[model samples]
Target: MEPEPTSQRTSANNSTYSAAGVDTAAGDLAVELMKSSVKATHGPEVMGGVGGFAGLFDASFLLSYRRPLLATSTDGVGTKVAIAQAIDKHDTIGQDLVGMVVDDIAVVGAKPLFMTDYIACGKVVPNRIADIVRGVADACSATGTALVGGETAEHPGLLGVDDYDVAGAATGVVEADGVLGAELVRDGDVVLALGSSGLHSNGYSLVRHILSVAGLGYGDRSEDLGATWGEALLEPTRLYTSPLLRLIEKLPGGVHSLSHVTGGGIAANLARVLPVGNWSEIDRSTWSPSPVFRVLNDIAGTSLESSEGTWNLGIGFLAVVSPDVASEAISTLAEDGIPAWQVGTVGTGSRPSGDFESGAKGVDGGAVRLIGTYRDGAK
Candidate 1:
């Protein structure tokens, strides 16, 4: 026993965990890189800044409300991240994440208080992670939500080095009586279609498939789109929370229900928030689908109607309101740069004989269908 073979033991222990692909140092750097952006979203309500084990938000303000209802939503940016990774653009994806998560909370007519993000990646690239978090922070700030805390996880063998996904959960507060839903929808409530920025964090799987079959690459520019395929498709989801919240406040009891036009498409989403047995005929002639929708349909040699269930078409959110205040809501949203218009009216009478989408997402609510031709003459 020559001192327990000290030299061999030293050599055997020399290989570090970093050598196994996990770099604690890189993770630390990433935290440092994203710290400022995360802190920028904080207000006086957020206690104990970033890098905390758990986020602290001031909820004492809820005491002022007669009854405060806490609303929480969690969602990811779907397959949209594929395009972001393809184009090496990490910035806008986080905005899409916030849109997916925080906007859902807004659907209940709640004001978001704070949010936390989680990033899963094969490796920690400080600048890229920072770019992603910065995007989330900016969107959170835009929606008046604090970016309290988040986690950046590195899975060396699980995900690709260049591949990452973003998800977030947000908490919001709304008065108990102010919570919006199908119960508030009336027989003649007007439906307003809030225009979407672009794809807005949904239906990318189909989009990518169509582009791939059409021999299009993310870097390829399309004259119809006025930018590279990735750039056009990567348009960040519009944060409707702030504007919609303002509209709700400005017009008391005017906005009955709000349906975020996400996955399940327009008819399904709208139907989910309408009273049971009540229905709506979404007149397509109200507005035209944007050029992006048209170009993709054209490339796929399919009708816009085909993707109706998979895409938002042009609408991003739907508002059911009293007819008296519908015009005002439209004008208010328009002034806020969100083009909105009357798409249809909730009806309790017999609907035309057709396949109406109802009970979508297991919500046995109302029936909805698209009638009339699109403004662009697409059926």
Candidate 2:
């Protein structure tokens, strides 16, 4: 079918955005390069080709579900890209971008349908651009998310040479009646810890600063690392959708909450959906962190307390479900090649692991005092 006009079609008001450092020419070139990448990932659900004024998808399929809900998440790869640039690695950041997002939707039990990216570079280098695109496409393909569109930007004035930033937006669908999200999270649910592949893209700024002070090479190789520093740091973020969907489908309808351990780590992100008056007790010893966490901790001499607060602490995505189904859910993840383990449980207990003993209702005006991760370290 012929495509429709884009939603944000730009007009020659060139005066307004020109100051924002957006260039029509560079943006145009970037779009050209990304067209194929986007189209390749599209399927019948994609509403139009890449150059359309707006990205679109045929949610017509939603009519079949008794309850239909559309979920969206937008995120950026933080300073982790800086490390990738420093070490001349561009691939994994792509996975990092997807991980930062779709994982959030996964928390709500929404299956990611399509994704678009925004890349800003001071100057376009074929090799560099290709590397990142390769990363983006690879991760998109892995997650079953169609890379339908993206924005490539060139701004020599604003973006310094060899410096670029990456961000992306993902849209997903679920039956309205079947939207599994923080709402499903209850006081008695279980939290499953999915293994992280070596600091899967967060807390890198601190990591770089620590290395800078210690005169350590981010790419330095040691037996402790199993690989070069760059290789370890650049390890792509894991895609949990397939395994997660499988788990949710395999398990009965009791699976309650899902938290994508991202920028906030376990403590912050999990609390987003946790029911008020409820507490999440995450057992730290449930799974072993990959070796990279210790290396970064040692390099930065990060206090264990701070590490728990800032880093993913080796657990990337936490799946919360009814206590009885938690183990089976974790196993289902393993069946699909994802490393998962039971990390914690939900309760009406005390701080960190339980609900706020007393507090006002929350954003939804619900009585809730959310406490995730009480005082135990996931050692």
Identify the candidate with maximal TM-score: 1
Give the RMSD in angstroms, all C-alphas superposed, for model 1.
Answer: 6.3
CA lDDT, every prediction?
A: 0.87, 0.69
lDDT of 2 by residue, 180-267 (tens): 7666776767677787776777888877787778887867775777777677778888888877877877885867666677765666
Q: Per-candidate TM vs. native?
A: 0.95, 0.83
Worst 10 residues of 2 by lDDT: 1-10
What clash count goes with each model? 0, 22
Q: Total backbone clashes of model 2?
A: 22
In model 1, the clashing pairs are none
Which parts of model 2 have CA positions greater than 4 angstroms off? 1-36, 47-50, 349-379
Q: Give the best candidate by lDDT.
A: 1
